[model samples]
Target: MLDCFHDECGVAAVYGNPEAANHVYLALYAQQHRGQESAGIASCFPGDDFIIRKGQGLVSEIFDQSQLALLKGTIAVGHNRYSTSGKAILENAQPFVIQYRYGRLALAHNGNLVNSDELRAMLEHRGAIFRTTNDSEVLLHLIAHCNEPDFISVLRSVMSQVRGAFSIVLSDGERVYGLRDALGIRPLVLGELEEGFVMASETCALDLIGARFIREIAPGELLIIDGKGYESVQLLPKLPRTAHCIFEHIYFARPDSYLFGHWVHDVRKEMGRQLARESHIEADVVIPVPDSGIIATLGYSQESGIPFELGLIRNHYVGRTFIEPKQSIRHFGVKIKLNPVKSILDGKRVVVIDDSIVRGTTSRKIIKMIRDAGASEVHLRIASPPTICPCFYGVDTPTRSELIAHNHTVEQICTYVTADSLAYLSHEGMFNAAGGGGETFCSACFDGKYPVEFSGMDT
Candidate 1:
């Protein structure tokens, strides 16, 4: 099957305790699936100085035992990133720490800034030299240039100008700061530990590090945790509505995470049930495209009264071929990643349930594999609607021209995937699967109705 763009960006931070850096590292490890392009950790030493180590690689590859041992501090922030706003490079890896008038700040940010290009231009005209191409650098520059006597006031001034989804964590030698956008387009939650307060993009990270779950950080909230104890300030009142990303329930988040007051795993399975009801496939066996689709496939199997089988086995040890560093090697990466369970599929009618189809290359390959495994008929059912448009907030989908759904009809997509039948969960179905009622969500990736405006300066 063809590959999809890797999930991008995860942030974790801790305030209090000398082992904060090590804790943040482990927290980021739990969120490694969210981003695999690069990893980094920055900590504020108790004496008000900082130590940072970041590089272009997975969390495990970049931070060895020795590296973690060296970073001793009381406050720290960590990040794992996939290049969404800029080309992949070590310089773009975060936590983006810089020396400023108010002292020094280390920042690890999740989500894209829709107005960053314009803000960056304004900063450049005023003589701000940028160190990285990613929009996160704009945050540090803004804070550095703010003339406000207090750092928090400067942070408020800077955050006010930033538009779009962002869940950011900053460390300024003593306290840890967590800020979320007014629209709340991305997920950010708070946790408590014996040593301090913890913040992460997902609850899975907190559970990984033995942190107790705390309430979610509200939209437009600025949280500060330090020796004086934890406190929150409403930088802006909660807007009349929230724009939480719809895809987080579909694919981005770890199943263990609790988001939007529901378990991610349960939500995905419900989406599959809804898709099954909408599609109503008749097949000898239902199969999932391993990993992401397992829960959905199970739900589909239950709803359709069809037996579920593991007809496709994934090689857990196959490091993502996307990181092979050579285009030629990457082209054949999927062959090593998945193997068809021939015995189970031989002479059977198969219905494959997947999360969604992006470019369609992967689904086509999967269908061909099932056919080759002797399946008499193959049907494809997607849990979410066709991703016809790219996501500007955080997801890394293709441009319109590259999206198979953007240019083709459902029947055409079926022919392309060589399936006996093809069906997708309707937009309304997805909304219902996520949760019922008239609650609003950001469906920009599915319907292209962005909740925020884009400046269109970055790829």
Candidate 2:
């Protein structure tokens, strides 16, 4: 799983819209790249009960015209999930709905809670019954068990008790609620639709439904959308510091989306510029590893004054069903996904750029493919710092032992990947390009300085 980092869940909610479910479906479809394991939507009518429909698959595969039509309501919340805290099972599919004294509540969460085990244990001691293994379920129990006078007070109390990253969207059959963690490890944005207001994990989702971009749901901020319009509450008065995940700019978010007020594509291009400044290579042509590497590769070419070429063509049709051969097949996995353009690579000194190298297996295969295509030289340049540590907030990463950078030195990694030469952007370079020298971003996977402590919650 570490060959490529998996994105966390994506959450979208719409309030005061006649076609709430339909709008949410379109938003989820736009953000489906964030998660593909499962999809779900929960809708609440003005005076009627909440309806739920969820299944394990892509958004399109799970919902049809009839299914979306059946989920009629004026308010809706939806989730696309990739498991980070629980197994890939139907039971773990999100937009978890529960009926309690407060009425039907539907919740969709986009991050991991480090204190989940401790919280679940405490809740269970007080006789809480759980139906799923997901950590997001802990929030439901916390909200349900609080003996506060109103829902907002109870939500405030629950927010204070939990720790680690969480960007949640929930509805209690009346209003839609959105909350971002104090550290802002995950992204949550607010948008405006003609029919109503909307909240989503990325702005691309907002664009899909022709929603006007509002500001992001700030860190430690709670957002409420209802017939009364948007309302704000400060959940956590102060956070130690901001720790916005820098990887969102590197790989996770769509290039067209905006993250932390910076255009994702622009940030990636700047990263490539920084990488080229730090490690410039003389070569015949520069090529990206396809899709994720395209923008960075363009920046590298522009900055290095080299011609850019599509030396490798990716087969966009490859899906999850492309299973690996049982027997040892040479580069079968990478082969199924990509192939080198012999015409472009033959007799060319190629410079290959990629966002990041995780396990190094895929990089090795790609280098070999270029070599086999008669490339005279392959100089590898990475757009970001070496990913030496695994991410724990939400992105699914391999263990430290599985990371190539953690186990091998740069020179050794270059040898392992069979590259003529290799260089990675420095931490300072990445910070300069993405954060503009601000220390508000989290580079835990590159620096191993986790913003949150997970000492007692490892189980």
Candidate 3:
């Protein structure tokens, strides 16, 4: 089975813009890293004629010249998805658009609908025919089947019926609808472009098209944007609490993106410093696992008074090699992806800092290569706690039996990785570094305590 580091999905939408489809395409490209399995876009022209183009591939691959030419509209919604709750298939691809009494509606969604199984069963029992197993189809069914008079009323009715994390964007060729979860499990932000307004999963997507960050869409808020600007409605009254995903800061989000008023890079660097403080070791140089761990490794070096060195040189042009279809080509994949700088590693005591270890396949390969490069001693320091449990939210994590940390103690894990010494950041330390102040976080993957009930889940 593939490692479970699932993505929560990404959404992009724009209203009152002549080139709305192009803008949404750019936003989705900015969020391509979030979901690579499938991409789609649906647009509603001024005449209420809807155009939708969807396929099972990346945004660039699906939105080719012929498809883009067919999707003509001034209001649009797009989705890039990684299968978190359902099987990966073309039918499960997102931007589930359909015709309704209100007009042609194009819907793109992020996050999962926890109560979808029950809702789908109820809808199916009521004579609703299903087209796909994707949870996004549920929202479309509700919107199209709603007896409510206005579009917003139909949306409100649908929102009230669903439960769990959802950040949705919809358009009826005239207005764009933006909605958030009752608990805010995923991130959504609004931005203003010269032509009109935009909404996306992350701020980085907004920056792609010169959109100025307006603010984060609050939990339980439903926002509508058009030529006149935007309006907000409180769909579900705020609960007494919030449980945002902490892994977004630790590993998922882009380092340059900010979430919940916290800078992601700053949080990661702080975690590295915290890790260094607890796992201080006498090493000649501190090395990072290329791009993701660079900031944190720099923090560790700064805090520990150790020199930071680029002992490992990553192939900048190499796309993620692990996702290649052929397993036969994966054994020596790291060699093509990363190469050690022999001069820096030769006869040196090096401390390698990585974000987290999953199956330990990549770590083992890296350790062997470093040793082969003549490093006298190798110490592995991880910035996050061990991932002992699977993440059902969106991350594709291996089952408990597959995770090395789940079966091995720290010493055993160190020996397995062939590291001279190994240490992981304490869970509490990681939380503090991520700006936690005793607030509840979804640490299910690291601690086996899911914030929400999962007994009924297929996970």
Candidate 4:
């Protein structure tokens, strides 16, 4: 299996700015990797209802000058979505907007709620209608139906009933709000424009728009920004332990982004350094799988004193669909994305570095491709521990049965991938590399020790 890994969503919001919609556009553009299934933006002029433009495609494909022009506002919220709780269809594209009894509200969310299916069932029993399958829409429904005096009370009431990771940004036709889960499993950062504030899923989005890096939105904090200014209300108490998703550093986040108080690139480099310390070997050269593997490979090269080469070249321009030949070709799907550099790999004892190996079939194909390019031997080194559990906190991970390492040993995976040797970074080394990035970071995918309690979620 060619593994599929995706972080479900990213959110960006702006308040009290003349070009708020434009800022959100750039933020979503910078975070395009978070979700490619759909892109959307919601904007509203002061005292006006929201104007939302949403569709299925990359951010660039969905948004342009005319579309952005139509969304005129000083308050805006935007979303890039790869669904974990819903289908990947135009109907589920977000910043989900609705006109409720209280007022016009729009929401864009990152991360998943574990109890959403149950909540949807209960709400449906009570005659609540749902427009989309997205779990994020559940929060809006709860808030609208609550018998609360104010918005903060509604948040206080609903946030306790729902469980799991969520970093949300919403616009209420006037003010913008940012909310993070009690466990902080997903990241949300606050930034500053000259005239207003920006809330985004990562600091990289802030950087793209020349916004000053502020601080991460604290766990369980609800930040509200309005005409007078912004204020923080503790919607829920912080958990005894934080559950920041460790995979964000391992693969999901852009290398340039900073999450959980650590620079993602630097953390990945340290992960490679630690892996090298644990699994160094005699090799003529070290090569990476490309893209996500590049930074970690640099650290592996430095730590192991092995020369690093771009032995595998990636075709970044390849589209989601391309015409293939009528005749069948082996590994055609992988070959279209990555090709080996024979001159760099010929007669070499190569060490290949990657973030992680999911199903191992792709690694097998890659190793064979390297051998076809005349490599003498291929050794695989992973930057993190073997994944044995499925992620229920917004990451799109395979089922336990589908993960190669769930039941297979390191040696078994090595044989399956046709590598001369295989090794994985230790859990101790991973946390040590992060310099205690999170005292309670979630590593359920590696160890099967999920922080949040759930039923029938193992799959």
> Each candidate's lDDT (Cα)?
0.85, 0.91, 0.82, 0.91
Model 4, range 356-375, lDDT digits (tens) per residue? 99888889999999999999
Model 4, runs deviating above 4 Å: none
- What would the per-residue lDDT of candidate 3 be over residues 1-459, giving only the tens digit for each residue? 012255668999988777888899999999987898899988876658778888887888788777777777788899998887678898888888777666677788787777788889988988888888888888888777789887767777888888767889887777888988777778889999888889998999988999999998988899988777899998877877666778788777778777877888999999999999999999999999886678889889999999999888887776434455465654457777788999999999999998888888788778888888999999999899998887755565667788889889999999888999999999989888987633546777788776656455433
Task: Identify the superior model by TM-score, candidate 2 or candidate 4.
Answer: 4
The sequence of per-residue lDDT tens digits that candidate 1 reaches over residues 136-180 is 999888888888878778888999988878999988887888989
lDDT minimum window of 10 residues, candidate 4: 1-10
Model 1 scores what on Cα lDDT? Answer: 0.85
- List ranges where model 3 is wrong by over 4 Å: 1-4, 319-330, 438-440, 457-459
CA-RMSD of model 1: 2.4
- The clash numbers for all candidates, in the given order, read 1, 0, 8, 0
Q: In model 4, how large is the Cα lDDT of residue 424?
A: 97
